[model samples]
Target: MSLTAVETLNREFLEIRCRILDLAAMLDRLERSDDTVADDPRLKRIHEAIDLLTKSASRNSSSDRAEQVQLTFSRPYDSAWLQNLKVRPR
Candidate 1:
């Protein structure tokens, strides 16, 4: 039998909480560092992903949050990616 929403949340709550705490700690560390990340594309993508999650949660949409987040960090596939990276075929 499939688990209900409450049952699923009960099973996963602690893991979810831990992950949020980890993300918060990482953000804190970054804030405390002297290195600048405001202009970094990767950090911009992280901000976009966070905004996506916040918006989706507020809407309570049934979209796949994990897939959305993953896409936020992914790039379009390039047919000449290997050539672009200058990887030699073995």
Candidate 2:
């Protein structure tokens, strides 16, 4: 049987909150660091994923936040990738 909405929230809320706190701490560390990573693509992808998380459910019809966040960090598939990387198929 599926969990009721309240039960699901009760079970998952602390974990979710912890993750958010972790992300916030990481961002804070980055901001305080001497090195500049503001122009890095990875940082841009992180911002994109953050935006995805904050988007309203009504604005986004699909409920695949994990997939969306993952895609934000993924490169487009290239058929020649293995050849480019010089990896021989077994």
Candidate 3:
């Protein structure tokens, strides 16, 4: 890729990100409302989009963090067996 290619992509990428966030926030509000949105196809598609984005992000993450998963323990001491506990940049 060249500089011009990047320049062309930057605005589009930012716009897409903004739109996705806005959509997700709207869906979040709907999910929190009293109405039942679980069976909604639109809601399902939103969830799927988020999952796909998360997996893609994980793939691009630094080596210091887990590639595709985040782990948690039941109790504080239950995680003692773990060794690596590094934080990665957002």
Candidate 4:
């Protein structure tokens, strides 16, 4: 991919990660509140948005890291390098 494309994707990934964190904070606040607004349809939408953002952020992070690995290991693969390719479980 072009440098511009990689830059764009990196920015998007950061934005999505930030958004997911923000949504998680908002959900925590709502869950702690005693008011009816906490149980409103808008809150449900926010919850769903959080779930979508979490998945998107995870996929983007993986893709970004994979691209970096490809760039870093452009030469013929070695056994040690292949062993290091496994992503640690989250």
Best by lDDT: 1
Residue pairs of candidate 4 with colliding backbone atoms: none
- Per-residue accuracy of model 2 over 27-76 as CA lDDT, tens digit each: 99999999989999889999988988888455866678888888888888
Model 2: weakest 10-residue lDDT segment is: 54-63
Question: Which lDDT tens digits does candidate 3 get at residues 1-90?
Answer: 556757877858989789879977887798789879799876665566567567766787444333222322122444434444554545
The model with the greatest TM-score is 2
Model 1 residue 31 lDDT score? 87
lDDT of 3 at 9: 79
Candidate 4 lDDT, 1-90, residue by residue in tens: 556877877869888679769967876786787875855765555455445545756786545543454444355667676458875555
Ranking by TM-score: 2, 1, 3, 4
Q: For candidate 1, lDDT tens digit of each residue in 1-90?
A: 999999999999999999999999998998889887888999899999999999999999847999999989998789998999899999
**How many pairs of residues collide in each model?**
0, 0, 0, 0
Error (Å) of candidate 1 at residue 27 is 0.2
The regions of model 4 sitting more than 4 angstroms off are: 1-7, 36-39, 48-90
Give the TM-score of each candidate.
Answer: 0.86, 0.89, 0.43, 0.38
Could you tell me which residue pairs clash in candidate 3? none
Q: Which stretches of candidate 2 lie over 4 Å from their true place?
A: 56-60
- Predicted structure 2, TM vs. truth: 0.89
